[model samples]
Target: MNASLSPLAILGIVAVYFAVLVLVSFLTSRNDSNNADFFLAGRKSPWLLVAIGMVGSSLSGVTFISIPGAVGAGGVNQAFSYMQVVMGYLLGYAFIALVLLPLYYRMGLTSIYEYLRSRIGPHAYKIGAFYFLLSRTIGSSFRLFLVAVVLQQFVAAPIGIPFAVTVASAILLIWLYTFRGGIKTIIVTDTLQTVCMLLAAGITVYYIAGALETDFSGMVRLIRQSDYSQWFFFEGGWSDPNNFFKQFLSGALITIVMTGLDQDMMQKNLSMPNFRDAQKNMLLFSIVLVFANLLFLCLGALLYIYAANVGLSLPASSDLLYPTIALINLPPVVGVLFVLGIVAAAYSSADSALTALTTSFCVDFLGMRETDVVPDTQAGTQVLEENTKRKRLLVHSGFSVLLFAVIMAFELINNTAVINSLFKAAGYTYGPLLGLFAFGLLTNFRVREEVRVGKVRIPALILVCLLSPIVSMVVDYYSAELLGGFQFGFLILAFNGLLTFVGLVTLSELGEPHGDDFTGTDYA
Candidate 1:
């Protein structure tokens, strides 16, 4: 099962992939071409499809390359330690289904950020949405940035194409397929992509196993008996990053903030019409993700064995390990699958994020509420619908350009293993969001509604949001010296939220509604 692995051949593969995605978009959006359809898939997506689609959207190309690399050499001796974090995600998803989903559904929110507006005031709402836009822009672009570098090395540079052109073309293909139907289109596209990525991984595993002269059952035994298969870090004590408690706790908190609290991740879940279906989707995704992640870890161990056996030198950066083997050292046909798998991973994530950013900006900043619409008359409704679509198009395009620029910037300076870097950055960016929602849901407290920028009033809660992460950073920087070399790892989120919670409590007066505080509507 081999094919041409030339740069031109890779380019053709990409074109066929885009063609399939575009066909899906056209079929999905043919009848209902409105803002609602663009933002939420017209609230008609099947739960199982959405669940399967989320696997690719969340893992992306970063996982395709980075997670395998992280098995150890590509990381800080991480080994099977990453699985501890997956266990934590189960707890986080449970919280999302039981607490967050009911609130969002009851509010009839098109964008979950609306819950911020209804619970806090306008400024806090914007702050929440602003954090989402900032966090996702950097995170999504970084994921794409990883894939772009691989494509440039393997497919573009040999053919004499510029890196920026390669980057632009990748983003453009995503935009072309996603511009019309938005999430409605992405629902099916992501499902197909999810299948492509997993199948590619399974096939790659089979090939590697055959090369090692082992069957599937034998391969499992080989992995289990090897040093690379080692899991847990009990002997490393509190200071070790791979300590089970630290990774597991961090995994849970990161899942809560990054997926449960995130607009891009939650948008797909909310697209389901009811809390029951959405809850099922979340539960299914949580379980599937655990098994799916194990496969990547297994693949990581195999890559190292293959490299050692064949006398291939591992690349300087562990992030390059998977790509180096798949694209260069393996069979040409395997190289082709590697390209498809990476692209499928990249688009699943990038497309979901692009749609989410546009949705949040249009609904949160532009004040295009789900409840705001034209009169019931046919003529008036037609004009309003047209205007909404036009505005949405502009927002979507603007964010796409912004994402392209950020990804280019990342290409210029990124030097770390991408999977670790992503989770580390998320610890800071998503910490404030975790705090805001925790204080809102757990306690009946209203923060000071208005603070001032000179003569201008802003959300008083902004001060707490700003202060929490700052203190968290200070703690993280000095944590080793301050706590006898105890590394915080991902648990920085918990410390950040605790600091935020205390700050909010300190500023409260403990009374009835103030001038402009939101105490959440009691809709029974």
Candidate 2:
């Protein structure tokens, strides 16, 4: 006889779990804390914990929903080929450790954008920060919206909760716990969330295998015989969606822009106690992320294999596979675990983004001092007077509200493809910053002093970095349609970055800023 679980039991379990989370938040907030403590966790976090928390933070609900679907849609290329991109991520981390982290450490930067001001100009700094703001706010909302839909379908409908109410409630729960301690609080909570998410995934996978009448090793053997296990692709040329060169290059760029450059992702990295520790975290994170993704990809393959055995028609959207499979094929416990994981992934990513967005706005555009709240000495009191604590509070809180509203608006529209495209398009916007940093760090080009490039005064080299990608997009748009689908691997964020490098070189005029004296700090 089959046993079933009550809807009330599921709902009550969920409510109690969230209440515990909120209670933790209230307990952690202390009177001695200020804005910095709220934002970066006072920059005293243990690196490994922060690094692991980051894994959950990076794997959003979109990932949870999409990976399974990807297996059936494009087969092995979609599921396993992403590993190539992961390899590229490792390489990109090397650049961060060797090139980017040292500069950030030396400058004592809170927001990475400050390096732009020191290296290029105020225009560059603002431009970089603005792109980050636009990208993360829109991106984060899209992510949360994905999870909210799942919640609406599973939990809300049975209880008669409105989607809007659910969305607001979800954000509120995150803010309640996260608003006080900021990154510091998030690090601990994110670790907890990651464990929950992984536990949920492991349980669901176990149930999935059980329902399929196979053990873990048997599932692995089954995948080996399946059609979706191939890893490398080279014969399809540049236009093929899984083209090796394109994916490899894309992997490298995605890491540079999305991980190395983006404020939301890097903010967590900055929370570590020191640069060396941060670098170690980044490298370890890369290794762990590869394995984490592999788990998801394998789950995707198994979901499809199970669906085929039962003669179930695959869902129209790939994102629904994880949920549908759980609800229909597995037992009630697995279904509950699947829903919990969905919520975990969504909240983990969205909360970090909301916090990081506020941190960047406060530290970069608002011109607040980085070490304002936790100064080394009492003399720091004078610098603190320059900006009122209340005004700073208003600035952060208002921005958070605005971001929430914007994300909600985007969620209401419900266009997943357009949202995905916008995220891709926004990746191009970071090219200029990548180019500017590259030129400033690697070469002796004096962008500010070179007067030859009209009134902007920054070298034409910098201008080239800004324009190269627009030019590539225009050229590729017209010339490449006949070739094939330009497989813009979700990971090829590096190509746009390289395009920015090309632009910087073309726009920059010939000049040397004392070639031998270049110590990477002149720009910092």
Candidate 3:
């Protein structure tokens, strides 16, 4: 394959892109670098910018490359079947807007896990936040790993840089821009990154059309005539991963758990001034996300069609197909767009994850309330604020290092398409969250936080949360044998949540339900 851009050129593009983000960070954080500004952008973010920025953060590099590649991979998400999942996302987003958003705003929460504490017990609260921390860490690490592999293959490796340095450098760059401004800076930068990502996908589709010697309508016709154009799968039965009902239900549950129950995604929504504005952001984001995913699936079909027409051999990993063509097979302009798009995708998600992780840790673990102010003179308040800011900075830096380490670990073990691995991991890590929230919202029973077992008082909520996923995993592994070829697929989230709800029920007693205003004490 002939290379269109040298390693230096690609590196230059990435540097210029991050320089713009750094400028945005400086401008956004210059006046206010306090915790409020860092965490929720002082609740002054525009709904539209938050909506647009979320498109990039939610899609990430996983969607950019994996979704398109999955379209033609002919196993999971074959052809337009992924659209069924997108359609399910609409239902999930509607639930979030109508149900979850109002509940969150009613509680006036900085961290959504606070809802668990107020409604259930302190053990439930800590357990909820722990699951989110685990989920987002693994999710963001997988995303960053995708971009690192691309860079190592196309840019860093050619220049004799090791993959670890490439990964470390990428994380460091994200940390530098995000450490001060936090989500406040991310709101603006993510909007810019969203544009870069969409443009890259659109342009690649256009160029592939030109190479196929077809116009826009003709390209559509070609895709329609192709084998990859089939969208719905009704006859595949329960075991087929691409079955319509399976994909649609999984899509809705995944969105609810990954977005509504997630800190990284919800932090952006919560940054808006009111729940109404946040609801608007969620609705608009869902609409735009549907179209964005459709565009990617179309691009995937065209890529495979183009490869076949040119007799180009497919890569070993489907995730590499987009970068392989964009860098070595297409024009230099497309190569540049690929670099910008991947970097934009990577930073958009990683920066927000880092901010949300820090936000959750400080608010949920360290007991730092967003509304807490030193009850003293102006000078004393400033001193306390400065001290709080130092703690936040340290936490933010710590998570960045953690992310780098996780990505390195992923490089050693990851063998499947990242999108698959991501959702599979989410099914386990996010299942407890789904279950905890479901129990709180849907049931009137109050759980006993501690259950006595043979003179040992155990945290029932934590044990339940941990065991739900393990049980779900065991059930999933032997599902075919036990259920006569019925596979759980992404529906594992729902099952895991159900197990948690049942466990919580066992720990509950018949009593008056807790009020919405209940704020339980932390256990010793």
Candidate 4:
């Protein structure tokens, strides 16, 4: 009763998809391949395009398969409980729009970490950029790894291609399209990818509904009546990972640190001509994201329902639930869509991440500035621009290799659903960024970049940022026994940030407000 796509067919579909992406890159970058165009899209990106693309980037392959799978997972994001986090995302986006956006815009920042340099100190700036590099590298690797696994299992294995070659080819395709155009090309490609991803989800849901012999309203009633319909959890108290309060708060904090504090997501936001347009993008994107996630959850329930109706055995890993059904149990068209959907979702995030990582390193570490412009006829300036462009290209190629290496590493060790692993890793890596930003925004205390400990000079901010997460890990591991069975879950980010804040306080002294200090009203 099942039909599947041939390896050649799947490869054809992927090739066609990348061909379009490459065409878009060529159109967008052929006339303008300068640093400004690559890094910030010359501050001319349409907000609506950025909003549409962000949906795909934010969802990624992790959400394409993992979220629907999570609906039946009966573990952390069981049933409709993930909606609580979505609601929290609404709140978090509001804060970013109201507070963080205005600040970044007023400062005219290319690298958001530059705010850290001006507000805190040079070391704080470097640490913030370092954490983003670490976070996005691990995060993007996890996303791409999920897609690689699916490709390997369903396509490459049949064709006798090794997993390493599969991963290299995937990264290579991304680099080919993205190295020149950067964010400008991504704005257009991500929008196209978002449409493909949503169409795949929507069509798959329709096919599943047909298989179940149910109409739309009937399917809704079935999901509402099923055991997986429960959306809120209040009886579990503090120890329950799905507790409403815990998830809601964790969701808000996660959005703040992941999107607001993150350079990968914020780079898109900053690409807009002004903060107002960026704010509109955020609001529209968040509202649409809530519905997109709901649709995925609905599809999850249908997958389970259809499986039970047909007596199909569930896959061992929930991550494989969507793929197994789409590839093996459904029509060949569904399998084709699944391949496109995952590729789109994965690259939407990965390409932007690669661009952002390159942007950060060139600006943050290499001291490349987009505003370092001179007359077109000035020979010295032209030479400097040429040198900078060469450096940018090398950095871009280096990150492409790094992403491939990291994905190969994940292939060796990753077992759980990538969404869970991604969030767990974010708790540790993004925690210090949260603390550093919060300290800069909320207080006027100046930290001594280097503190004299007896006879030696110690990097004070670095020491605090480094120590905070290690201590948080220890506390998280012992939390159940130490705190009477209280599960930290994703709230470890909050605790880790708190520890960093406390540590920073120890090395700070209250100083008279200076002209450069962010008073929260300077721009208003």
lDDT of 3 by residue, 1-524 (tens): 34547888788888899899999999999998888788889888899999999999989999998988888887888899999999999999999999998888777778999999888878888889999999999999999999899889888988899999999999999999999998899999999999999999999998998888899999999999988999999998988999999999999999999999998899888888888899889989999999999999999999999989999999988898899998878887888898899999899899899999999999989987665577878888888888888899999999999999999999999878898889889999999998899988988898875878799989888888989999999999999999999999888988998999899998888786562355422211
In the range 1-524, model 2's lDDT, one tens digit per residue, is: 01353456556666777876777666666553466666556667788987898888877776677765776677324757766766777788888878887777776677888777766666567767877887677777777877777777766877898877877788777777776667767777778778777777778778778878899889999888898787788887766667776667666766777777888788887776678888888878778888887888788888888888889898776777788777656887787777678777877888788778878887776766545553565667755743535555565567557656865686667665432454465555665666666766776555543435455555444455456557656545654564455545443344556676655555455665422211222212
> Candidate 2 at residue 391, lDDT?
53
> What global local distance difference test value does model 1 have?
0.83
* Alpha-carbon local distance difference test for all models: 0.83, 0.70, 0.89, 0.89
Q: Which 10 consecutive positions of candidate 3 have the poorest summed lDDT?
A: 515-524
TM-score of each: 0.95, 0.86, 0.97, 0.96
Candidate 3, after superposition: displacement of residue 466 in Å?
1.2
RMSD of 1: 2.5
Instruction: List pairs with backbone clashes in candidate 4.
Output: none
For candidate 2, give the lDDT: 0.70
Clashing pairs in 1: none
Residue-level error in angstroms, candidate 4, position 226: 1.3
- Of the two candidates 1 and 2, the one with more favorable TM-score, higher being better, is 1
The alpha-carbon deviation from the true structure for residue 371 of candidate 4, after best TM-score superposition, in angstroms, is 3.3
> How well is each residue in 374-416 modelled by candidate 4, as lDDT tens digits?
6666887878878888999999999999999999889888777
Candidate 1 matches the true fold with a TM-score of 0.95
